[model samples]
Target chain A: MPLRHLAPMLAALLALAVQAAPGNGDSGTQPEDRSHLPQLGDPYLPPAARKPAQRPPLAGAALQAQARAKLQQRFAAADTLKTGSISLAQAKAAGLGYVVQHFAEIDRQGSGRVSFEQVVSHQQGAR
Target chain B: MPVSLKRTHSYLLAITLALAACGGGGGGGSTPTQPTQPGNPADRGFSDPLAYSSSGNASLSVANEGAALTHHSLNLGGRVIDYTATAGHLIASHPQTSQPKAAFFYVAYTAKNQDVRTRPVTFFYNGGPGSASVWLHLGSYGPKRLQVGYPATSQPQPFPLVDNQESLLDTSDLVFVDAIGAGLSQAIAPHTNQTFWGVDADAEAFRDFVTRYLAVNQRTASPKFILGESYGGVRSSVLADLLEAAGTRMNGVILLSPILNYYSNCAVYSPGEANCTGFLPTYANTGAHFRLTNPAQTDYAAYAQQMRSYAASTYGPAVASWLGSRLPPSNSLVDQLVGLTGARANLWQANLSLHPNTYQFQLITGTVLGRYDARVTAPQGSALASEGDPSSTFITSSFASTIRSYLTSQLKYTAQTSYAISSNAIQSWNWQHDGQDLPDTLPDLAAALQQNPNLKIMVLHGYNDLATPFHQTELDLARLGNVPGLRIHNYEGGHMMYLDDASRVRTKADLVTFYASALN
Candidate 1:
């Protein structure tokens, strides 16, 4: 369960930066994802099918620990700017702002930084 | 719990949020967990197996009428789900002559596991009034997807596609549909697309396609679901009503980043108009994403929740009073609008209220935030923000070419007609249907819900999408006032939320849960 929670988040923050695809827009709300796609044509030869992209083969159970380790690395990297805590500017620039923003949301005591344990505790309560 | 705060915990908390979304448990409820599927390279097809000429874009006239089927398997939910991929045509013929004229195209994936009769079937499509199904197909739900580009990153050419781990094949069979004049589907000799391009007519055509598909596939007894994104979301609502009336009752309807109300989503509404207020929370969310908001605004979710409440209860009403000077405008109101929108109070006063378009460019002084995903910005794009969606451009660049590779190479569904992902059909579309309900689909949704109390609807939105902001959906749903079977879930991404790896996982789980809850 913990693994389930960590995988997508760690992946999403990185993935939102990646965009590829064709013809996905809608009128009014259409993504305009379709606007720039190159048109298709070639009468004789069949277009070679593309391979499907994939996440690493790690199971959900491994994702929790994997995610935690990756996060510590991220924090360590950001710590170069400021030890123990990443500044708001650092967080935004690193594209880790969503994490900081959410922590602040549940950081009820008005404390600048929210601890992992507090988040766990609060989440348990919220659930 | 330790009260000590650390910035690192923000990352941990994100995991929790993602987990909350994933924890809905998308596993097939009744189908016992089969042994974990072993990894098979061939099952997923060759890596970068698709290749196409780069001299120019592919032609749009080559289409084959043949129904192409390919067998495949993917490792999903820890199980190897074997399935059939069919790229087929649903021909629309003259009712009197019974002669085929035009053809509607679809790509379907039916899992080899479980009884075909009882397993759920979900039809997926994108909205363009004239768009193909490739967006939702490869972008979100299908097993294959073109490489997605990151913000500001140019996609590597010879666009590569990859196996989609987040494919919804875990709980339901998928059929991605393309409308007439899009993809391989087009108008026929006996029948012209002129009749099929309107709102009502389009709905009827889709209805008949589903009916014919079910009859041909012999899946009339399966649990049915309709999923449409963007304009497709609007279409999904109308399609729901049409399908039910056609005696094809669906168990559920799923709308992704849906725009249920056109007026509320767009237009120059008077200051404090409902539509203007709807953009408030989205504006804040985008601000937080880009760190444009006050640094003191730490908690993004809490901020958005508070904003939603204000928008629905207080701010929305306060803004509406500006119409005709019915209620004298107050400084406090302007200050509140400024506070909520993060733009200058003077700007708010000048405009009477902050519109999404005005704020789109204003939030960040130089670049424009994408309409599909407000968090992403492009300095060179049109400031109007209406020229096209920047975020979507990044996606289509990859998908447009990749699908051709998929259809021709993978599915072997060759056609003499060229594939049109985004079609010109929208240009000729007839919008004059029923004035009683302008362009909004909320009325259709309400009636559909009433007609079938058993029907379930799940409206989803991307947190970053300004085009169909999550908060606007909240406002619309609130107006609907808690119908029994309708639920709303917002993922942490833009219009095509699934493009974001995290949102894709979260959405797959959400869709799976919706299917299970509604169908089971």
Candidate 2:
């Protein structure tokens, strides 16, 4: 980032020291009442919440493992994998974006639902 | 401030330079075979996820992939300053479901080493709800602009991007945003275009983007302003009020050739029709500029001013009375209209109520004046109503092509998606908002200004522009009951008047003065 953009980040960090109090309900809370947020269903919503200070996505092996765990927790743990696939709602609740992310890789047959083995393989191949 | 921060800045600059050098093989593009760098920022490289500070909201994840950042130095207003230009995407998700929505493309410029609270950052938008920010980005005062000489000024071609000393960067940072369908911005997955294809939806999206940008950038405490052109001028009024209501306060707004009310500019007069004589003065000014007016006067400003006064006093009333079947044939009024607009005296006398389009065509019969700036004219090329705009003929590809080249060759923002300077979003755009006031943004503007009396507004217009005539805006503002800091300035050129050297210089002076006034 350039210094011109840096000043604000620095200022926010300083402000965050005071403003991020529990009472302020600062944006750190995951999945808050976003219904109240402007431009509902806005395709660009992710960036809307991306303040200067954010925790970037998990990358590499960590990301792969997390994806697998999230899938397993949302699918296999719920026995949805017994049907050899999971629904779109299952994928979303797991914090996985279907069309935009690697959901297609796991859904090997081009079907919306992915087989349990395919999900495992997809995570394994994510290096 | 911190030594570590300084070191990181140097490191980032070094990496940015190296990346730029790696793509230096981009030749002066002539043929497709030697294809120079493309303008898609996505082709640059997938970037590290933008991580918020670990201390606050560390869980927020933003994958603005392919975002490119680079630094450039320019001597603006007699001072050499290094500034950074960034090309990136802003992602959107469903507010309730947190389902990923789409990516909004944008480019931003900021002067290095400055306190932002008092000084401000301006987000710029070009008119067509579907228009890209490229025009103002490379055309006006956005750090770097094109040298494609506009008509009535210089010869065309040799569109090179150079450091614009007139850029507002010396005063404030700038971020040019592409409305959803324009430029590289788009709707993702199941979200579809309809999700953001309307007025309320568009305003909310833009408002969210501004809020998110400020929050993410940690500029929540900084002063913010919006600069919108054309339809974006109307957008600025709604944005000013919406953003402020959404917890983001604006210090000022700059409207360029703003169309405050649609009925005023392009209204069709009929039974119960409001006499929109706003285009009269502009028709006369356009006539004056082209030396088409009969019994023409050499003094342009004086003649325009006189016509403006007559538009409301005599011309407007005459048309309104004619609509009521109460108007009488007035010979001197016809002569004045003929002298001011260069139209045949009989056209004015025979038909007291002149339509905006016919009035435009009659000014230089058979040749239509450009809808953007009447000062321009071309061979009446087509009979198609769709292709009627004459001034738009040059600016369309001129702005898009130059911006693409500048971004690719100069900033190294490359992607597979071709840059679109403008799109047909206007055709599909849902113009309906909460307020059914199509022709007047004054209520919303007044609402905002009333809430923040300290907020200043600078309305700039090119006198020769017939599209969003300056006189119409003058009449519109006149009815808005005592706005404290609203000042309108008229210039010699047409819409996008900054294309002229003199206009650009004068416009910048006014801007510098405005920004300075706000700072104090």
Candidate 3:
């Protein structure tokens, strides 16, 4: 079978192994028996009653890449001189707020302009 | 491997020298320091939707593998403690279907040759709501600590790691577990990390993680404890209750610089409408620290106590005037506020409430006090500056770099994917809990107390912590009705109290007493 078709099968096998594994370890090590203790109800609100999750659709590198792409596009647009770099004034005009904020750090050589690579590397180091 | 080597060059050199002294048996297991990327989706056991490439190329996924165990000994002052470090991932699955949902990355340090039944095990996590457990692992009670001085930004070069004389390893085994989407933890296929980002769901995931950890390590009979810092406090409150339901009874629950209730956190309220009663004492303490108070109080604790009494007696009742009737604070109250908080009389008159930001910015000329730590200040930066907290900026790089070095070079657990020190999922966190839009976990804690009266609770605070004011935690825990099992201690440091050398020693001593009491 193709690998895509095998993904769910492997997941199922892993899930079965997970289910078969002992949970609470009532043996091996002497475990506490809390049968006499009062039992508590469900710890969470019912799914219908609970508030919906509010997480952003994209996450991890995918989200970061989207953001990075936007910045690069902005930089490209700002580099109207086609000198392969953007000056602080051009950055300011394009509303590249982050570039304007860290202009000195990005323009490390003090050339008053920064390449797209410099911006990318700076962001990676910051992360 | 070269990338890993480059990042850990300094630490690798140190480890090489140290191994030479130890006669070379202390190296971590044969697990590769850099894990090979999974070739296919099935190799990782599931398809990771998060495994995407911006370039539309083949994406990489973290391999599903067993832990890498390393053995080492630390000479903590004089007494040496030999410990085994287990660094890896444990799968947390769906409750009903038992399908793997998320992988929780954890680093566990257990004293070698200790009896599994008797040795205590404590789980530690820092709270960003989306933060990794790196802070508690490197900055606080772990066997090795990242050294960065307070009140000034840490220099990037020469980030050092030292044996933590105050490591809790002597008292109990420590396990630092990162939440899903943070550190090396990741969500499996069909369930995104967002599935566990809410208040209740987050607690459930942790409850599963803890139970799984116990079963796998055969630590079920050990005296159990959970320590949560900052937003981890919220997770702990709910987790404590959920763990009880799962039949894992903890001996103690520790809250460090916790925000137990968000309704009164001042972040939820508009400026001038926030409750100033809880914040007054913290402001007074900060003022005294800067010698900004009128009396030039040298004794910060005593001044804070005086302010606390005044707030409870006079300011607490008078707060209703502004919060309810839009009435101005009494002139006497205004005078007292100005004298204690170092704010101008006009500012206090115009607004009875003093927001932390206003105090942080206006407390001193040309300097901004840290929100996490009022004692640390920096020359104000541009409005669009990436980092706003002086406390965070100065010390963050040191901690960040040190963790990566320590993990790969020392602990020997490495990953292909970048370890996220913090995730951005908090931007869309579901705040609703127990029907309140703003979470108040005190009820969950109270329920845990009711269910397990034997559960010992200790709430710690730093007097200089502006993020979670000490007084608010005091007021929140007061509703538990004077339970003797509960102990609250405040130190003179910031939110991460262990960052201060003096506070770390004091806090460790306090924890030593707490662990003994709980175990007994």
Note the chain A TM-score of all models in turn.
Answer: 0.36, 0.33, 0.45
Off by over 4 Å in 3: A1-127, B1-65, B154-158, B382-386
> Distance (Å) between predicted and true CA of B74, model 2?
1.3
For candidate 2, write residues B81-174 as lDDT tens digits.
Answer: 6565667665555433545455567787766556555558889988665667777888899877876465542345546677797899888878
Pairs with backbone N, CA or C atoms under 3 Å apart (clashes), candidate 3: none
Question: Chain B alone, model 1: TM-score?
Answer: 0.82
lDDT of 1 by residue, B350-412 (tens): 444455555655555555666677766655434323344456555554677778777777766
Candidate DockQ scores, in order: 0.01, 0.01, 0.01
Candidate 1, overall lDDT?
0.58
C-alpha DockQ for predicted model 1 = 0.01
Worst 10 residues of 1 chain B by lDDT: B46-55
Distance (Å) between predicted and true CA of B503, model 1? 1.5
TM-score of each: 0.68, 0.68, 0.71
Which segments of candidate 1 are over 4 A away from where they belong?
A1-127, B1-65, B93-101, B149-159, B267-274, B326-331, B381-388
> A51-93 in candidate 2: lDDT tens per residue?
2212322333443344344334435643444675666556555
lDDT of each: 0.58, 0.59, 0.67
